[model samples]
Target: MDETDQAIVRLLQADGRLGHREIAEIVGLSRSAAAGRINRLIESGQVIVRGVVHPAVLDRNSLAHVGLVVRGPAEPVAALIAAREDCPFVSLTSGPHAIVAELRTSSAHELDEALSGLRGLDGVQGVETLSYIEVLRDVVGPVGETDHRIDDVDAALLHVLQSDGRASYVDLAAHVRLTPAGVRRRVLRLLDAGVVRIGALVRQPGRDGQAAMGIGLRVSGDPRDLLEQLGALPQASFLARTLGRYDLILTLRAYDPAEMLHGLEQVRGLDGVTETVSWTHLRVVKETYAFEGLAP
Candidate 1:
């Protein structure tokens, strides 16, 4: 969107839970005014507010990503994919599968079970999966910079932390050229302000060595509520609100598709959940959460 909106996104990308007031301080705007702008950005489809879960630490087993190559026109197949709550970050672009998504989870067993469910889908097409063995880096921040209100320090903080969410206060202080405590204060402000949230990521699904499966969910309830339920569950990760064909997009790791199906069954007639679609990942070459910025 516009510069102000981009600034808001930049702030939230660092931490989705940041409040309008803190964001206003970072972005040089009034709290109410910053909130108005953020609301507008979300309404315009340029940015969204969502809670992000760290799968690596949260789940002992985790699902990295899945590639779905359907057998028909991309639109309808994409629509089916979109409706499922488990398939949160989907992209229907110029690719072999017509639809690609980064499924986040930590269970090897759950991952396998989800694959079976995907094979059962009516489309009757091919599926490919890629699992991330090593996460070189991960960042949660806006990708591009169209927002001009942010200062150099703020921008640098966004850029650096997007690659490493757990950067220490000492490192941040050094990079930002502030005292360690100063950096810590700023970081605390960022978190309290909702500019960013930091937590340990569960690299796998279960401590018992069970596999995790990635399931995509499309729900009828407020996407946020559905995400809250899934995120609160010990198996889900990588929740997002998207546009194009779905109201919300999310990824979850379960002991197996049955458990996921069971989860869906539990959530199914609820006012918030409508449908859940799952796909097991075959392989993952590259997966990064580093801010790639906005899509032009």
Candidate 2:
């Protein structure tokens, strides 16, 4: 991805639902120009813009991650299953030797049905279930754009900030070819407009920093309310509900097994939580969001 692509990614990362005019104003491109760029990005499969609703919030508690350890091959199975709308995340690797997928649904019974569908698949062998007690969502690749405003200078500033949020006002001013005050004002506008999420990229320490342990949860009560309450917690890094043994699936970081177990316990102890399963970070193998390429 080049400079322009990175800028687009940043804007979407902050607000995937941003409109064409808003993106154009910030990217310093014409409305048509921005539209064309977004179209190309979407067509190329480099970015996916969608409304990821918490299934439980919608009363669909069937969510699951099916870790498939096949015998003969994996590529075909991965390709075949990736087409499922319920299959939001897919990964392929040979370490644990399998093609694993993170699937979603609305309830546990639906999850059983989904599993039945998977088990009926030709190459599928085994399945491990992880229950998600809580799911935390963040701006991974843009969501919606209720708040956004960008001008030529603002777009230039955002381009710089995505590369380094800590860049000084003076440095940003120089890079964007704007006066110090102009750059500062634009920066303030971006913040006020919510074009970029400003926060520390803090690591939880140890291997946890390197691996995203996926956990699934089965819960009771109003599943969506439970997910919303859990999503509001500080420890939740990523959260979603699916169909299977668990109603929710989440990613977390920890130092060791003990930490992971502790985190799992905390999740299981929630008011409406029924149970949970903690999976070791065997391997991420596949994640489109982790591509980190503004351009493919």
Candidate 3:
């Protein structure tokens, strides 16, 4: 995690399929050296490159944020929720809610069942849910419709990419029985249509004194202007309008406590903001964008 490593990560975050030579050109290193560093980073479990299927493709349109109040240890409850396929983001925080998780499902009924399952778990005292009305910003990439229909070959490619986003076109061709050129075309089509995004998922926050916080805001007037303002901030990672105790929710990542406070204060100064509540993430039990199954 030196400056060069950080630069390489930024490149991968933009496009995980970047070749070592390309990365080396930008980072000012030999191709083999760049490749060595990237391999070490992945081997160390610091960064994972994968294809993140859009919710539209999987029919996981129903998305919600659930905060749990546990009677006993929160780690066990968090671990239990993390094991569920639908829950992608889960963390233990320092706030009234001991654990917070995000659920993505195909329908509202499934969402209810998932919540009920959570409530039935031992040590679960209460559950607070925030259903997303509209996602303004996503951590993966721009949200788009499922313009390209997924056939068997496409499905195979997606599944492989989920495991290894930087899989060579020749390797992908062998998997799907298509020519390398054809495989490349199909992969590009998926990326262009936004059906899938190829990027790096940081398993842990950067070791450079970085910290993250979740902020819930209650806004008054037209939120459109406010959203535009908040969305432009560099620290704002995720943003959404939701149906719950809070009108808007977002996650901010900063280098230190003072920087986090500054970001929060900036949000408070926004015109339409009425009140705000926040919690520092004590531990991120799980944060993954990859899904298990892709329907054909």
Candidate 4:
């Protein structure tokens, strides 16, 4: 990606619903040129802009990370883990474990059933799970908004953009019987209300040998101070305070194993952190930004 592409990506990263005109003004390009650049980014698999529902609106609220030790090649097992609807993230990495997967379910029973199913998969050796009590922060936006109360028209727009964040205003208007301008207005209202978040979902560029890792920190002291410190780190992506065997869950992306290890050590060395466990994410199979709440 070039400098202009990078700037565009950054803007969309903040707000995928931004207009080409707004993006052009910020990035110093013609409106058409900005639109074309966004299209290229989407087509090149560099970014995906879409409407992401708050977990509060979903039936599946339980979230957990599972680490797997495979008996043979990890790719096939990763594929199997990826195929499951609840397993949104599956990776094969070089670490203490062979495969790592993230599971989202509606209840504790569902979580257990999903983990059991993973254990029963062919070539699976063992499974370790870390259930999330709560997510403090995520890639999409802040947590703790459980207002599943959108009206029919707004719901329709969300359903449409749940699949295509960059869906045209005309198409959305047709779906909801609004004018193109009306659709644009409603979208902005929803975004401003924090009822929905739209942004590009892109993989961490591996150009610099970057790797993503999951860290479980066991904390004995007040977590706020430690969380603030960890949150400021550049590599930190997802940070959560949990109530399981571990107190905090962190997701970080580093240039390589050494950096990843160093990052872990830095967390381990923090004041509130008592112990630490880490896993590397090799591949991400499915991300659950799309929602079923607005579906018919």
Best by lDDT: 3
Residue-level lDDT of model 3, residues 136-180, one tens digit each, is 877654464565678878888988888788899999999888899
- Which model, 1 or 2, shows the larger TM-score? 2
TM-score of 4: 0.84
Tens digit of per-residue lDDT, candidate 1, span 131-177: 54432223332211122233466546655665555466678778888
Q: What is the RMSD of candidate 4?
A: 3.1
Residues 1-296, candidate 2, lDDT per residue (tens digit)? 45675577557645554677998999899999998887776666555553233243223345455777776877777777776666656766434437667656767777777777777678888776655443346424222242454456655555555444446678988887778888777766555554544432221122223334656667886668676666654345667665556677666654345656666667777888777655544444334322111211
Q: Supply every candidate's count of residue pairs whose N, Cα or C atoms clash at under 3 angstroms.
A: 67, 31, 0, 1
Task: Report lDDT (Cα) of residue 102, candidate 3.
Answer: 96
lDDT of each: 0.50, 0.58, 0.85, 0.77
Worst lDDT run of 10 residues, candidate 3, spans 139-148
Better of 1 and 4 by lDDT: 4
Candidate 1's C-alpha runs over 4 A off are: 43-46, 56-60, 83-86, 136-296
Give the candidate order by descending TM-score. 3, 4, 2, 1
Instruction: Report the C-alpha displacement of residue 52, candidate 2, in angstroms.
Output: 17
* TM-score, prediction 2: 0.47
Measured with C-alpha atoms, the lDDT of residue 7 in candidate 4 is 74
RMSD of each: 17.3, 12.9, 2.1, 3.1
Better model by lDDT: candidate 1 vs candidate 2:
2
